[model samples]
Target: MTEQYLGLPIGPADTAFGLMAEYDADQHLNKVSLIAGAYRDENGQPWVLPSVKEAKARLAQDQNHEYLGIAGSPALINVAQSLTFGSNMTKNLDKSIASIQTVSGTGANHMAAHFLARHLRPKRVYIPSPTWINHQTIWAGVGIHIEEYPYYSAETRGVDLEGMLSVFETTAEERDVVVLQACAHNPTGVDLTHEQWARVAEVMKRKKLYVLFDSAYQGFATGDVNGDAWSIRYFVEQLIFNGEPDHPGLCVAQSFSKNFGLYGERVGVLHLVVPRHLAAQGARSELLGLARAEYSNPPRYGASIVETVLGNEELKGQWLRDLDTMSSRIKSMRRELRRRLESKETPGDWSVLESQIGMFSYTALSQKQVTRLREEFHIYLLPSGRVSICGLNEKNVEYVASAFREVIGFNSN
Candidate 1:
């Protein structure tokens, strides 16, 4: 196999399907010049939040470079639990929750998937049809069967709630894990209302299904940390009342990359909420064993930054303000994009752009239209018609909107 595969060796300098295949010879990096992810700034440069800079300064001045434990800094973990579950959360304070530091949201997700696949032996894990691109890959990599439930409706450019409920009610009984985006639904940006979340909780409770909530954007979604956490908190409350003693499986994967402006830091936490009866020493031992085999232990720097910010009251307050600023910018972009598209009377409905909330908007553009935007207009976006709202700002919003209008309208003509 090696001989045959190696014989067809293509050097790294070539492009594999569009993604750069190799680093540049001069800079030891790829030559492609495109906004890599949804990240952006007014000047098209990366913008670090002022609050994060201050926190980093404080951390750097302190001479604590010691390695954190496998479970991570207890202070950070406690703050994380509080932020997600709320300050007055009865469940969190009860000490029944067990959390471990992870590389990031993706890493936390992968860890949860592996744990479920090995320990629970669930038949399959159900994910949203239009979930994050890496969701399928991460779960499938751990030997877990991946199944999709209805999510986006192309005609309406919104969620197919009825269709989603139908799938969950029927298929949940056979699945071991059901993955949910706690706040901001990625790519589409359509979130379930509080009432809708209650309905989902009901269905999951009746089915006795285990849930894994992936919260990548937390405060970055609505600019209010508590607001974004409502769904997960509600689910936790429901699980506490309904979960059986013999079986407890409610987990949360939280990311600080977006909210804390710590993307490269790769800091996040994976929390497993169990019934008080099951909170014995043995459970923690099992979790540690799983961590030891995976990545040995999570990194220290990112976790340290998180610990510092969350631990210090002043820094925590500043972080909240920064989150508000970032969220407001994304919200403004959404409005601007919608206004531009509407003023031009671009073909098709553009209401979804306004209705959807978070860092992304589902433009409802076709694959062909998206291609035209890239080839003809030099605008980059996912083929699924999703645009990162963060990619829009004062400088480029007009150009992006015009490009979108030209491609979409021209294609319709």
Candidate 2:
């Protein structure tokens, strides 16, 4: 009784954030950080996109601090909706799509969990085996029984699609919620092939599972926004317009954090889509109610920057080019790392380094090896051997690769 009433136990710190804090205090001149999903410039510094810089300059001439509406900026949402579904695609959606701007992707995801846990009330929610560190934390807060589906296979170094689909067919029930990464999957950068995506969609549509797409990486993945969003678009066409009206709906939690480099400004949108036969206005109103109870309103500065850039033709073109520049740099770094590792004859198959996409790579280095790298070599990366590829640049690429060879070099366990 005394223990119950006294005080709560201290919770564990978030692994990524904790490691980031440790990195900041290390003070080692040669220390390299492969933590944090945030983007870094060629000089290993935080980058403000050219489009964002122009938008900020525009705002300086006419700046004001004011609260956005409960649902956030209308212009921003419209542009966001277009970027996600494409103008032509959204035109076909018409009244079936309901959207609201949120604090960011985390907020969008949290809001989705809360709203779905209360209303949709699924019997279970299925998440990937290894995912963003916060996925389980967010769902646990909503009081839903969570299940895991096999996502990656360390043996094949690729997606375990058969294992994933088998679980869905065997254990997953109707109306169960399935969380999916829209593009550039986190931790492990493995994603499904087009045919693989179609297979999963077929199983999902047949089973009537509600899909919650986490669209944190859109244009950032392949520098082609339309190509990155193909899965979501395909699913909508197959499930909503083609499936039953009674089929549970799907939602997309879109983030501008990566694509627009608006990480700090916290700009995101959640779009809930119902079957073509149903009206979404009622659902939209309820979402507004949920938002009102939460942050009261979303941020203003980031939304303005994104809207200004996307709403204009020239600025939008510049933004597209910016995506290409960032993605190209990451890809180049990947190739260099893999080449250097192979040239030096480092241990395992280093080809995966080049194949994985986006900001992170899941180096097969074990936890013990990762610890040795941090302790002996002054390098920083997640214990799971995940590294932010953006952390590598021209100056330090060889040093980092050499460090890898020293730690797990040639035929050593």
lDDT per model vs. reference? 0.77, 0.91
TM-score top scorer: 2
- Stretches > 4 Å off in candidate 2: 1-6, 410-413
Clash count for candidate 1 is 1
Q: Tell me the lDDT of candidate 1.
A: 0.77
For residue 111, model 2's alpha carbon misses the true position, in angstroms, by: 0.8
Q: Give the TM-score of candidate 1.
A: 0.90
TM-score of 2: 0.98
Q: Clash pairs of candidate 2?
A: none
Our tally of clashes for model 2 stands at 0
The per-candidate count of clashes, in order, stands at: 1, 0
Cα deviation at 317, candidate 1, in Å, is: 1.6
Q: RMSD of each candidate?
A: 3.8, 1.7
